[model samples]
Target: MSNLVRSELLKIRTTSTWWWLAIGAFLSIAMAFPLNAWLFNTAVEGNAEDVGLTGDAASAPAQAANLYTSGQYLGLMFVMLIGILMVTNEFFHQTATTTFLATPRRTAVIVSKLIAASLLGFVFWLVTTVIDLGAGAIFLTLNDHGTLLGEWEVQRALLLNLMAYAIWTVLGVGIGTLITNQLGAVITASVLYLIGTQVVSVLFFMLSSWLDSLAVLKWQVLWPAVASQVMITPGENEMLPAWWVGVLVLIGYALVSGIIGVLLTRRRDIS
Candidate 1:
């Protein structure tokens, strides 16, 4: 298992795609700095009418938390693409044959890929978090907005954002595995994570409007992103499940996708 995991890491490290993905994710984080700085400055100058600065939005902690979380979220798509490519690229280049030949037990190979993808996700999360936080703090300081690095609320938000990124990456891996075609997998993940959630939310809204009794379904977990929003943003949505329940829902999505992918791969003929 250890050897298999090492081989997967080596495969990733040897590829130009990994570096590009990492660099892209970092660049996304870097780009968020200016946007956040502008937003912070605008709010500071009492131009919070356009932005979502409602009651207490002028508070330092609130501003800091928003800056950090928003910046980290910006990089989420890139990391997920990395995860999708990690698996789909194998099939794209016809390397899965060699990989499976080296490890006859397809389950072991799948597990190794999961482990490698998880590690890659964590590394991506770390890079994005550090860059976003450092840049955000600098911008805030320069604008005289003050820093909330020491605030417990800001600290907790930072941790949750990192965890959310990591979880999303793993989910991407499962999605990539299930959809072996590179383009297909990427499209599916994008639609499911990005568009699918909004569609579901809208549908639920319509259903509840037509039938108030159906409102109960609104609280039921449907999408991983929705569950994650519930977990990270407390008290904002009364219809969302509890934080722990949201965590479980996310885990369920990742695990079920992995299991299905493994089963399909075990029966698939590489040649």
Candidate 2:
């Protein structure tokens, strides 16, 4: 275990990409807090979300939670790219073979990378949460929407958001394993999250009620909004899964990817 962890840390330390990814996550959350507060101050207060949804419609805490979290991750795009690179570089850079020859426990390598990435994700998530929340609070005070802070919902959101990002790092590792090429994995993930998925989701929102079987969280809408909406609202129905539902769906993909990556690393001629 120590050997595998040492190998993973060495690999990450030798690269500049990891630092940049962490920085990107930091900046995204930092900017998002102030921006969200301004948007809510201007837009939500101006009939933005329709009655019963904003201003006096719902709990101020809920509205504040939604505003701070909605776009809290503009940097996550780059963060995912860096994560893909970390896993796939072994295949591209001709190191996986040598490492396996020395260690022989192939699965250990993947697990080590998964653990490292998860910790890295957690650190960034904590920093991002602090700054983002602080900024929201300061801006809210300036704008005269101050509160004395609420109860467990904020704590729940912070914890869940960290778990979500950590899971995403695992998912990115899986993508790197399956593709075995950093650029391909990053681009494919980006397309799914940034473009293709969102487009389909918007269309679903327009047609959900009419479709009879369609719900806002159908495949189209569900994952696309998962990153933004997971902690922003409480579960609506007892039948509905918790906020981590979509994230759990994502973990299945990560497990598959990681297992296949171990197999490929063991068998493939990693030149």
Candidate 3:
């Protein structure tokens, strides 16, 4: 059991993809520093509404969470790539056959990959989260708008956002394992989670505006549902489901995908 986890971790360490993804995640999160500075500076100058935040919405804590979480969502794309690579690499390089021969139990291999992906994803999240919040705090303090480092809501949001990144990695593993075609899996997962959801949300919004009967579909979009769970902020509309509901919806995807991936790995003849 321990050996499986170790092997998976070793697999990750031996690869260059992990480091490159890590660097990308860091840079992606770091972009928030300057953007946050601008937002806070403008809000402090009484232009909060210009930034789409008003009243207490322009508070330091609120802005800080927004900045930090904005990076988190952006960094998710890289983390998703990381997760996709973790499993697909084995197949791409024709290493899965040897890996299964050594372990014999395909379930163990899948479980190991899942566990390792989670840990790796968590590390990515931790690094980006630290950099994001740290940079935001420094910039906010320097700008005299104060910092939200000690705010409970911001802290909670940070934690949830980190969990969301990790969850995406797990989801990536499931998708990668199920699809197997490296490029296809990556593109499919990206489109489904990233672009597909946004398209659905936008279309739903448009339809709802034109015909109120379609308003119920607004809460059913995949990405926004998950976003509501992971984000500490409210959705752009009031129709999205509750946070817990989103969590369950995401978990449903993870569980179903993981199961199907495992079943396919067990049944498919890996030549």
Candidate 4:
């Protein structure tokens, strides 16, 4: 298993895909951090209502937590793409047959890919977290809010953000398994993740309004992307489920994806 994972990692490291995704993630963080900081500042500086933030939602701890976890929206998509590529590449390069024949244990190979993808996700999370913390600290200090690291809310957000990254990557692997065509998988996942989430959110909002129930809004977390956001949301929110609920929703999706991936791969005719 260790050897198989190492082999997979080596494949990733040898390719340009990983670095290109990493660069995209970095640029995403670079653009998002300042914007998030500015929005947080705007909300706190007597215009909280303008941004729909009030009371606890507009507090230093909550805003700082959101700021510190910046770039997660797009970063997770990139991480998921990495996962998709990990599996699709095998089929794309016509290496799936070779890989399965060499190992003979399809389950082991799948597990190894899962591990490798998770590690890549962790690396992405680490890089973005470091960048967020550095910039967050500076921005907070200049704005007189401090780092807010001492607060449990901020810490929890960061921890959950890591979980989000790992889970999304695994989900990506599942997506790849389901869609073997590399280009199709990438385009589908990217569109569904980036655009689908927005469309879904809007639909949910319309539904909630039509039904005139705030409870309907909570259902939005069922979407993986929204779950990721909810999981890292600090403090209490009436319109969303608890942070732990978001974690469970995401875990449930990842588990379903993994099980399906393994079952499909075990029976798949690579030849």
Candidate 5:
């Protein structure tokens, strides 16, 4: 058992893409800085009088932080792909047989890889959040607004954001395990994220609405959309199942993928 874990951990630590993910996370925060500042200073505060708005000025800092974090979230999609490639690439390379031969335990390997991926995901998430939140505070302070980083809602959002990113990382690892081929896993995740999750679903939903002449059954085509919305908003609108439901769905996807991958690996001939 220890050997299996050791081997899996070694593989994860050595994977080149892991470092790239960290770098990308930092880069995402760096790029988002200016945009966050612009939005906080110009739109939220500047446009207030013209738009006849009246809200707490502190909300601008919070909103700026959210926008900054959003950029990091997008970059995490690539990190997920990186994880998938590392986890699934082993099979296509025929290295799993070597790994199993060394450890002779299947489940231990999956557990180790899952743990490592989750840990890496968590570190990236936290670092990105701090970068986004800290930079946002600085930007807001520079504009004559004092720091507002310790708000309850911001902390909650950061926690939820970390969990969301961790779930996606685990899901990506499972997809990698299930597919085996690195390229297949990457293509599948990319499609599910870029096309299936957002563009295709929204377009399909819109088309459905148009065909029904504004009387369409909206709930029928809301899986991906609801899933995304729930993850971001959690219990805000009760629009879909709570964020916990999405978390469960993520776990289910990862578990099923890992199980199937393990079964296949165990049964296949190793020549």
Candidate 6:
């Protein structure tokens, strides 16, 4: 298993895909942090009612969480693409046949890909987190909102952010497994992640309004993107489920994707 994982990592390191995705993730974080910090500062000063923050929402922990998790929206998408590329690249390069022939046990190969993809995801999280911490600390101090590292809410947000990175990558692997066509998988995943979430949210909002019940809004957490956002939220939200619910939702998606991917790969005709 170790050797298989190492081989998978080597494959990733040898390619340009990983670095391109990493660069995208880094840029997303860099561009997002300052904008988020500015908006947060604006809200903190009581001038931005449209920012949707009030009382507890404007607390140090909440601001810190938001700052620390900045760029998650696009970062996760890039990470997921990396996962999709991991499997798709195999098929794209005509290496699937060789890979399976060498390994024989397809499950081990898939698991190794999952492990490697996950490590790559962690690297993304680590890089983004370091930037967040440094920028967040300075921003917080400038705004008189202590670094708040001692706060559990801040800590939980960071931890959950890391989990989000890992799980999304695994989910990507599952996506790649299902869609072997590299271009199709990448386009589908990118569109669904970047646009589908907004479309789904709008539909849900319309449904809730028609039904005259805000309860319908809670179901938004079922979507992976929303679930990711929900899990890292620093405090209670009336419109969303508990933070753990989001974690569970994402985990369920990853598990289902993995199981289906494994089952399909076992019988797939690589040739």
Top model number, lDDT: 4
- State, as a TM-score between 0 and 1, how close model 1 is to the true structure: 0.85
Give lDDT: candidate 5, residue 68: 43
Two-way lDDT contest, 4 vs 5, winner = 4
Give the lowest summed-lDDT range of ten residues in model 4. 233-242
**Where does candidate 2 clash, by residue pair?**
none
Can you give the TM-score per candidate against the true fold? Answer: 0.85, 0.81, 0.88, 0.97, 0.77, 0.97
Query: What is the TM-score (0 to 1) of candidate 3?
Result: 0.88
Which prediction has more favorable lDDT, 1 or 6? 6
Question: Candidate 5's residue-wise lDDT over 1-271, tens digit each?
Answer: 5555566657767767667767776776677666656655655655755443234333564454455465554555766775686577677777877777776666666677677767767877877776776676666677766665566545655676777677667767777867767777788777777666666556656876677543333332234323433444423221234555555555566677667766765675656
Go through the candidates in order and give the clash count of each: 0, 0, 0, 0, 0, 0
- Give lDDT: candidate 6, residue 211: 94
* Candidate 4 structure, TM-score to reference: 0.97
Q: Per-model C-alpha lDDT, please? A: 0.75, 0.64, 0.74, 0.90, 0.62, 0.90
Looking at model 5, residue 141 earns an lDDT score of 76
lDDT (C-alpha) at residue 232 in model 6: 90
What residue pairs clash in candidate 5, if any at all? Answer: none
When sorted by TM-score, best at the front, the candidate numbers are 4, 6, 3, 1, 2, 5
Residue pairs clashing in model 1 are: none
Which 10 consecutive residues of model 2 have the lowest summed lDDT?
50-59
Q: Candidate 6's residue-wise lDDT over 1-271, tens digit each?
A: 9999999999999989888888898899889999889877777777566777766667757777888888888999999999999999999999998889889999999999999988988999999999899988888887787788888888998999999999999999999999999999999999999899999999999999999988899999999999998899756666767899999999999999999999999999877
Candidates 3 and 4, the one with greater TM-score = 4
Winner by TM-score between candidate 2 and candidate 1: 1
Model 3, residue 110: displacement in angstroms? 0.6
Task: Report the Cα lDDT for residue 47, model 2.
Answer: 54
* CA deviation > 4 Å runs, candidate 2: 42-58, 67-71, 144-148, 203-210, 213-217, 221-228, 237-242
Better of 3 and 5 by lDDT: 3
